[model samples]
Target chain A: MKQMRRRRVRRALEEQCFLWLMRLSLLGAVGVLGMIVGVICWRGAGALSWEMVSSLPEGGFYLGREGGILNALVGSLYLACGATVLALCLAVPVVFYLHTYASPGGRLRHGVRLALDILWGIPSIVYGAFGFAWMVYLGVRASLLAGILTLALVVLPILARTLDEVVEMTPVLLRESTLALGATRLEWMGVLLRQSLPGLLTAILLAFGRGIGDAASVLFTAGYTDNLPDSLLRPVASLPLAVFFLLGTPFPEVQARAYAAALILTIIVLGVSVSAHLSLARLGRYVIR
Target chain B: MGGVVEQPDKGSQRSESFRLSGRRRWSDRVAHRLLGLIAGALCLLVVGVAAALLLRSLPLLSTFSLFELWGGQVWQPMRGLFGYAPFVVGSLWVTAVAMAVAVVPAVFSGIYLAEYVSERGRALLKPLLDLLVGIPSVVYGVWGVLFVVPLVRDWIGPWAEQTVGDALPFLGRTSPSGYGLLSAGLVLGIMVFPLIVAVTEEVMRSVPREMREALLSLGATRWETTKCSVRRVGLPGILAAVVLGFSRAFGETLAVMMTVGNVAQFPSTIFDPVYPLPALIANNYGEMMSVPLYEAALMHAALLLLGVVIIFNVGARLVIERLVRRIR
Candidate 1:
């Protein structure tokens, strides 16, 4: 009886220890995130300046010269927006095809999704290399156009998969009713579009956020320049690249500028993420199971 | 005679409707096939990327024998020494360190969130994990430089040099400057923590409630139930998560680049500087065009990186899928 009681006490102690360990792990994950964001904000705030956002860089910017990342900020927006638009155009049709045309849980649907998953898993740097190689073959230089095309390829899978998930959640009864009313396949697509509009919007925003934040993918393909890109053929600056470049320099001022660029990039991503989360929460009701 | 007449009239009307809709049905079929073709073409894009990488890297393959290119330790592109041993080893070491540091906490957190936490707590934790995922690598890189590197240099490095360093011969040769394999690995570990936790949580959640209930009824404690039944069922999935996280760490560029001092060497100690393939490419791609075989070498490196990552990801997916099938 005494031995049984001792065993029970030990088991209780072990359970408590296990629970605390698990909780500690949770705390660790949250702590790391909080620490990273906290440190970036603390350091980046000191570097943020009105002139930095308002004006372009002057001469000798890399050597701690007076300059702002206006060129990079504008370039990043152009690249991200362009990529998101182009990706949406391609992704919507593919997603629609998967849902409307393919049989439920068919081989073709599985194969296509598996392919997309593979593509999605391919690292961004690989996309950059592929883009660079393709550009060389096509006799095109690294420009805004090249960056957008490359980024589109990167974000296409993401947008398609997210939109596909939302579409798949759409009730089969809805589809049956629409078809029962003698709706054409094209018209059915319109119905799916209407139903998944909120989710689709969220997907686009998420893709844009991803495109804007990725640095390695565009590192070589974007071909950064000091001046703002006026034409699609010219090279462009981007926030990720700007942060990467400035951080490399030894100068304190330029390093601070890198932090500021990071802050802007983080803000954009955070905004998109929050908006996506909000939309998901609100529009979730419209989705029937 | 009346039934026969009605059947003939019905057949005639059906034929007329079929004829009337022929052109419309043809267009519909065409549209369906067209969209299917587009979707298939999207799948083919990955194959195209592989081909492109192979074609681009052929120049390097021609210059150096396959064995020589992969087997050589040095990677001086300017001097035409395009061996990839150091970079590959560097990548492996860093990823190993990251996995070692991250896997335990990630698995624990996954268990906590999936089995132990309240629904409200799970909701709060999940969004925070998403936030972690959304934070850019560049931000992590900057943070690493500001905090992690210094912490390692001043405290962790010295402590390790005194304790683990004395015990382990390789660790005895430590760098006073902390930015090296260990720092890069730790930062990568932190970056990958959320992904690991997320995957683990999913795998743990998929363990049916009945299994937990049965274990508890059999006089198993919550910990024992989780460790024996839940973890046993989810082992393959946990491994898949680790593989995925490892791939993420292996391919990570900017954060590793910033934290890893770009010395082209096989790190003898965790403190010693090392350079991975991604960093090598990112740092040198600009100057590569100027040099002769440099561009080819970088292409080769990219191809190698892609092959490794794709293999890992595809293999992990297969394992996870099998695990899901078994669970169902």
Candidate 2:
């Protein structure tokens, strides 16, 4: 009886020790990551103000008083918006036709997915390389048009994949109804496509979020110019570019500016994603698969 | 049986629908053929670039001997003798060190959001991590240059040298180049943290809850059970995540370029100047100069790096798929 009681007591002790160790291991890691995020935000938040957001990053974010991110912010908007529009225009018909009209035995669908997977798998630097070779090499220069064109390809796979599902989810009955009405192919496409526009727009927005925040694709093709972008051929400074440019400078104030810019970029991305989720919710009934 | 077989009325109608929808009209067939060809062409485009990287690198092969590129220690390229030893070693070492620093904290953040947190917390954080991944490397490069470089040199440098002494080669040296192995690794660790956390959380969520119950029922506390059940189950997924992170960190260019001191020699110490594979390419690719061979050498480096990354990526995908099946 005495020996058995002793054994049970030892087991209890072992269990308690293991539990304590695991708790410490998991929480300790959490503490360290939290510290990193906290330090960055605390240091960065103090450097931002309304004036910094409203003007150009002319000299740098020296005091959060002199230069602003207005130029970069506007440029990112234009480039991302243009790319998103172009990608959506190309993707919508391709996606719809693949789902609604194409035969199952066709290798076209398989090829489309394979192409997207490859595009997604390859590094963004390679895209920059291709853009440099094709556009910059041909003396097209590092301009906004080249930047948009590069980003469009970079984001096309992601946008196209998501939009394919959005189109696929549209009721077969809707297509059938149009077919029975003797409507021409284009007319049917117009009506059904219009009805699914909101969901399609959501996918485009997500791609825009990705495109706007991307720095690698723009580095070679877009180049850097501080002035407001005037023509499609002109180089532009984007928000991420501002952050990138600020890092290498000598000033402590400039580093602070990079952080503040990071904060803004984070907000814009969150807004885009939230809008996408809201749109996903708006797409009711067809939400099954 | 004869009546069923002879039912031609509805069968013909059904066959007609299938045949007409199946076989395309001339214009329809032309359009189908055209679109499929276009889509196929795009696939060819991506493959074409990857192939070009290989083809562009062919000239590099004639310049550097295989043995010299792999096992040789010296990297004196100025005299036209190219050795890839320092770069390959540095890339792998930095990647391993970075993953060690990265995995633990990333797991905590992921677990905090996935398991410990309430619905509100998950809603807020999932998007933040997504944003973190979206942020550009140039910005990260900037952060590394201004903040990470100084922190390493000023604080980490002195402490490491004093504590570890000459035993730690990289820490012992003092160089003008702020580019060091440890700092670059830390910056890279932060950069790829989100990918690991995101994928690990996904895999963990799929793990059944019964294993947790079985452990807890046998007197294991929630925390203890998690370590054994959830953690053990999550190990292979985390390992795959680490490989993916390593490949990215190893192959990365601009961020590592700006931060890592761009010296060509093999680093004797962490504080000594180090060159990574991607940095070598980025710095040289733009400045291919009158020496056409220099560009060829850089292309050679890109090809080797590409081969390594693709192998690791394909392996990780397979591992993750197997892990998923086993869990299911």
Candidate 3:
């Protein structure tokens, strides 16, 4: 009895230690996140100005010039919008086919998803390099068109996979009930689309967030310029690139501007993420578990 | 006879509906074919990326043998010495350090969230983790350069140098500049922490309630049950999460590029500046076009990065798939 009591005490002590370790780990993750956002906000708030959001970047911008990152802000929107549209055009059909045409766990669907997973995992720099190589081969200079295409390639797998997840989560019964109504496969797709509308929108917003913030994939492909892009063939500026270029220089004011750019970028991303989460939660209620 | 009659009646009713919806049927067929074609194109795009990488890399391969490219320690691209060892080694060191630092916190947090946290707490914490993942790599890069580098340079470097530097030769002589493998690795650990947590949490949750109950019924504490049964069952997935995190760290470009002082040297110490493959390509590909075989050399590096990521991803997929099957 004495030995058993001792053993119980030892086990209890071990359990308490384990519990503390787990809590500390949780706190660490939360702490890192709080630090990143809090620091960005603190630093970026000091640098935020009306001119920073309104005017074009002037000459010697990297040398701490007079104007702002407006050009980059607009250009990022253009690039992300174009790429999101392109990705949606390609990704939706594939996701639809995966659910409607291909049987679950079929070899063809599996192969396609596996290929996408591999593509998804390929680093953004590789995409940039691939874009550069393709541009060189085709004799096309760095332009908005090239960046959009590259970003589309990058976002396709992400969007498709996200959409596929939602579609897969769609209760199998929904598909059957719609078919029971003598709905054609196309009509069934419409029902699935309606059912997964919130998810699809969330996916688009997420991809847009990704494309807008990505500096590496678009570095060489989207060749930055001080002016906003006037045509698809013209180069474009992006927020991430602005941050990179500004922070790269030795000037302190310019580095502050980089923080401002990061702030704007972070806000856009966080806004989108939070919205996506909220919508997913809200619409998720309607989805059959 | 009754079944045959019913089948014909059912067939007639279907034919009547089909006749009524002839135009809709044609459009549906068209939509199906169009979607199928798009799917085919999307799949082909992945092939296109691989093919383009190969074609671009071929020129470099034909000019420089693999021995001259990846075989040596020297990496002076300007002088045409394109040895890949330094960058490869740099990537290895950074990834190793990142995995070492991140794995414990990440794995424990994932387990805690899955097993220890209340539902309300899980709901709140999960999104916070998602927010971490959603933050762009560039932002991480900026943060690394602004905060992490300075911290390493000023405090961590000095502290480690005085305390552990003498005992471990691998720590290498500390540099006050702080732009080295250690700084980059620490930032990368922060960047990849969320990924590891998310994946490991999913894997842990899939461990099934019955297994936990069995351990609990045997008078095991929650910690003991988790450690012995749930964690043991989730080990493959945990490994997979770590591997996935490693691949992400290896391929990370902007954050690492900004923090890791871009130098073409084999690092003997964590404080030594080194160039990674992605950083090398990003920093030099533009100017490289002016030099003979320089562009090709950079392309080779790109090819190498691509190949490594693909291999890691494939391995992750296999391991995760096996884990899923085992659990199911």
Write down the TM-score of every candidate. 0.95, 0.76, 0.96
Candidate 2 Cα outliers beyond 4 Å, as residue runs: A1-71, A86-118, A135-140, A157-202, A251-267, A270-289, B1-42, B62-81, B107-125, B145-147, B166-179, B208-235, B271-273, B284-286, B325-328
lDDT tens readout by residue for model 3, B1-328:
4545454554655646555377888988898788778777767766787788888778778877888778878877668777899899888888888898899999999999998889999999998998898899999988888789999888888887888888987775556688988889998999899999988998898898998999899999999988985557889888999988988889999999998898877777888877888898888866877887787777788888888888888998899998888878
Ranked candidates (lDDT, high to low): 3, 1, 2
Query: Candidates sorted by DockQ, descending order?
Result: 3, 1, 2
**What value does the lDDT take at residue B232 in candidate 1?**
76
Best by TM-score: 3
Provide the lowest-lDDT 10-residue window in model 2 chain B: B15-24
Give the TM-score (vs. native) of candidate 1: 0.95
Residue pairs of candidate 1 with colliding backbone atoms: none
Off by over 4 Å in 1: B1-27
lDDT of 3 by residue, A20-79 (tens): 998998898889888999889999989889999999988887787799999999999999
lDDT by candidate, in order shown: 0.86, 0.70, 0.87
Which candidate's lDDT is highest? 3
Q: Model 1 chain B, poorest ten-residue lDDT window?
A: B1-10
> Candidate 3: misplaced stretches above 4 Å?
A286-289, B1-15, B18-20
Best by DockQ: 3
Question: What RMSD, rounded to one decimal, does every model reach?
Answer: 2.5, 5.6, 1.9
